[model samples]
Target: MAHFLSESELSKIESEKGKESVKRAVKSKTADVDNEMRDIREQRARLVEERKKKRPQTTDKRTIAEIHKEKREVQDEIRRIQDSISCDAKIVLPEHEST
Candidate 1:
């Protein structure tokens, strides 16, 4: 004969399963964030390299300004990603709360 779980036991198993699901979701999100951060850093490095090269004779103030703007935008994006990661780290799951 198969054993049936009581209500409390079933709820406990469900809660544990939910917690595992949440943990997997969090890990997946974190991995995605890491990949994004890596890509942004690579882009930032490329921008720096580009800035170091000599500009062509036809290069104008507008072009130079645009490059600078792009660099600033990349920097801002890095900071935002970092802040988001830190904020995410601080989150407390409801199921993790102590009674």
Candidate 2:
């Protein structure tokens, strides 16, 4: 003979399932945030390396100015990436939507 669950028992079971689903979603979001952070770090490292390699050895005014401009641009990009990392670090799971 098959046993039937009471209303309260069914509700408890559903609540547990919902909790598990939320946990899984949170875990997945965390992984995505970590990946984004890694990518941003890699991008910042690459920009720094490129800036180092582009260092000028000349005393020419125009060349120095161009190098400085490029350096400023790279610095700005790095700053933006840092800001993005900071934002991602503060990520929170969204609330469940009612169907």
Candidate 3:
């Protein structure tokens, strides 16, 4: 098969393909991170609820300090992931095309 593509054209096409792959990879990673954050939030909410349901007259499932500590850890984890991953689709275009 004969192909008609200049070297520069081929380079551009290859770069475009690479960008597409990068976008997909970033999207997948972002989703995974977002899901992890959501799970952490849900876990923290459950902990808060469980801690609040203790009756003064009965044995509690967990002490207040323990619940607070776990909640804080979860919050920290969420912040860590949020800083490392962008939930938004941050597609990075080639510099020449960015303008």
Index of the highest-TM-score prediction = 2
Clashes of each: 0, 0, 0
Question: Once all C-alphas are superposed, what RMSD does model 2 give against the true structure?
Answer: 33.8
> How well does candidate 1 match the true structure in TM-score terms?
0.38
TM-score against native, each model: 0.38, 0.41, 0.39
Record all residue pairs in model 3 with backbone atoms less than 3 Å apart, i.e. clashing: none
Root-mean-square deviation of candidate 1: 35.8
lDDT by residue (20-61, candidate 1, tens digit) is: 775665566567777878888999999988977855457788
- Tens digits of per-residue lDDT for model 2 on 1-99? 223445675566558778677566556656777787888899999999999899876588998899999999999999999998877756643345323
Q: How much is 67 displaced in model 3, in angstroms?
A: 31
Of candidates 3 and 2, the better by TM-score: 2
After the best TM-score superposition of candidate 2, give how far the Cα of residue 55 lies from its true spot, in angstroms.
Answer: 1.5
lDDT of 3 by residue, 1-99 (tens): 123445685566557778676566556656777787888899999999888887356545678678889999999999988865654324454456655
lDDT per model vs. reference: 0.74, 0.74, 0.70
- What's model 2's lDDT at 12? 68
Candidate achieving higher lDDT, 1 or 3: 1
Query: In angstroms, how far off is 26's CA in candidate 2?
Result: 0.4
Tell me the lDDT of model 3 at 2: 22
